[model samples]
Target: MPRAPRTRRSKYRALSSLALLALAAGAVTACSDNDSASDHSASSSAPSSASPGTGKVAKAKLHMVDNGGHRLAFYVTRGSASTIVLDSGGGEYSSQWKDIAPKLHTATGATVITYDRAGLGKSDVVPGPWKVESAVSDLKAGLGQLGVTKDVTLVSHSQAGEIANCLAKDNPEMLSGAVLVDANLPQFFTDEEIPRLVAATQPEVDAAKKDPEKPENRQLISTAEGFAAAHKAFHEVTWPNSVPATVLVSEKTPFAGSPEDAQRWRDAAASFAQEAPNRTLVTAKGTSHEVPTERPDVVLKAIEDMFAAQH
Candidate 1:
């Protein structure tokens, strides 16, 4: 309940560097599908093939489950006792866990679940702007259908952290712990700061808008919608104090922003960790924002720590 420490591993200097960093980092193209709000009724039946680039389609470990009438694809690493659910960032499929899932399983012997969100990979494309509520619902429904109703640890990256937060908030008893890898936190960006932050992502937005036909572009659009939704959703929610959590902030790979912006990033991460009853911040070095890909060991260790805390 005491004021959380100002935990940081970097330094900040000026707003000029911040502005330039804002420009260079915030250059993602500005684009959104206005029709994403429309809900399409896709068949909830699971598909036999894995989504493209969702790693090897090992049938024995593959699952297609109905998450509120929409079929979602999941790749599982079967283990006894605990189940670690890997939630990828925006624009990524379950394959993003390719480098870490096996290692996690080997290290902890916990069942690892990684899957594509509604419209990614081999999953059916129903609608756009996958809201945080919908995302969390899908995850919970998938787990329920798989008969995994207990002893779960959520491991989330980037925007997917919103879903993890929602799950942890509403279903503390359902989760053993949570690990956020270079994730977006609740209310981390202020209104005045939002525009500046959006500016930095302009390049990514532009690229997606330029090529509607490209799969990458489509995926980017889907990811963008999820980001937009998170921006609004995180403000309305609160994290529960009961669930144990760890937030891994990447020090080597700073966000594309000024030193000041970087400081904000670190401070936000620290704030997220400080809010919960049992939470810690780990400054991950020698890695970029893609810490799961670059430093799977950090993620694995975090998962291990979370499980240990529960027992």
Candidate 2:
């Protein structure tokens, strides 16, 4: 396919940067030595013979797999229970879970996996917009490459929650459960609302672009156009009622907006939970949209709650 014109590409890049910045600040940063961060997994737990689904966290191995031409980096903390796969928010790297994953592993005693999607962290970037379907495919391909094909629990934050939803819908049998943290629910967004949503998040994008040296400027995991595309795609997704899920609603909103805006955020989260047959909503009283970072405890508890509900 022909690439978009340079002028269009620039516009998409600008919007994508804004969308990402608004939804998740500090997501785009210069790539670092993957070993420096993933090394934390080695200290998390030791390898054990516990069988899958036994809730035993063993030492995890770091993996850097080639997803087609792009790299997908992840840390697999081995355990005996259903593996918990952590999916970060839009443009956020797996390191967003750094403060949470180790503690979560220790607490749940289940294998935990956190990874950088196609273009984040140390992974390679792809062409054009980031599609929701493509993101789901990458997760499956990345997991399959690691020899993980079943008994998986998906824990996703923010925008990635949309990807997790599609994963559960398409492969209900593969998932043990799902945990959504302040996830985006396109079902709740109307055509009129999208532009408003985009507009609301534009300031952050503008701020990032205003300063070209900002690391986030280079973080090209998902463009605003990609996010908008995913939002539309999510509307067509049908999450299986058979998949146990836990949706966490942060008390704070993404931007410092009116109380009504915050309420709408909460409502959207609540609506997502209501749609699930086997799901519950847990409101984190003192955190913002950066649930995984600001309130790892809540994220951990929500995952634990989902596991308990399923088992």
Candidate 3:
């Protein structure tokens, strides 16, 4: 394949101005979560203020499903060919897939849909100390409730890697393929292996449980909550899903990692290929963590590549 075009620095430069934008947007329009190795501090150029479920994103068609007695909120962006159900990261719900899913739908002629976990977005936050299985159950029950049939594709980002993996492992019949965008690989970094990463997220979690609706407390809660959600999400994820998988990972290692970490990430992607043989691991250069926002076109190509390869 040829080299992917570099995104202009100015595109990412606006990250600095996002916090004020986030606070003003009235809390959220997307969803996010974190892992042990995930970043805690806002980069000088990261968009700290992009709310996951508010403002322009509020118009997203909300859907509900029953999971273990709790009603979960999920959203779908309708398209007309095949359907793609995307899982957003921790601290994030269905709203994070807002722009990118639509793009994928248009480019590939697929219907892209995303939704929130139990308490993450428009859904009610229930009791029982959420676990990774809850997420898996949510996906299963949600799809069943929505009347989504077999032969679907899974598109996920960050912590959502677990959701996609769980589906592929238990119910291989539902999938045509899987797309992992900056995904998690427990074989490389497990729950116990990322304690420091977990510790950094407690503050953010506490802040969200304390006040998810406050604008002044945004900085205090965002990172920690995101990390806590992701840490919980990591336990259920695994490799060897039966269908062909596409792993889209970032080339840059900003911190909490080394050059070898990228190598490890690729090696994990390589492992996915080893299992499926048809799995394609594409590296989106000049990015880490937030590939969909940092460089969507690169992510877009990987989707096209995998879908094409399957045909």
Best by TM-score: 2
The window of 10 residues in a row where model 1 has the poorest summed lDDT is 8-17
User: After aligning candidate 1 to the native by TM-score, how far in Å is the CA of 94 from where it should be?
Assistant: 1.4
Ranking by TM-score: 2, 1, 3
lDDT scores for all predictions? 0.63, 0.63, 0.54
* lDDT (Cα, tens digit) per residue for candidate 1, span 194-306: 56655665565566577754554554554454343335435455678877789898884345446766777778888888776699999888776667877777888888888
C-alpha displacement of 141 in model 2, angstroms? 0.7
For residues 223-302, write the lDDT of model 3, one tens digit per residue. Answer: 33343335444333455546888888777632224454456556666666566566777778778667777787887777
TM-score of each: 0.76, 0.76, 0.66
RMSD to the true structure for each prediction, in A, is 10.4, 9.4, 11.9
Can you give the lDDT of residue 191 in candidate 1? 55
Displacement of the residue 23 alpha carbon in candidate 2, Å:
15
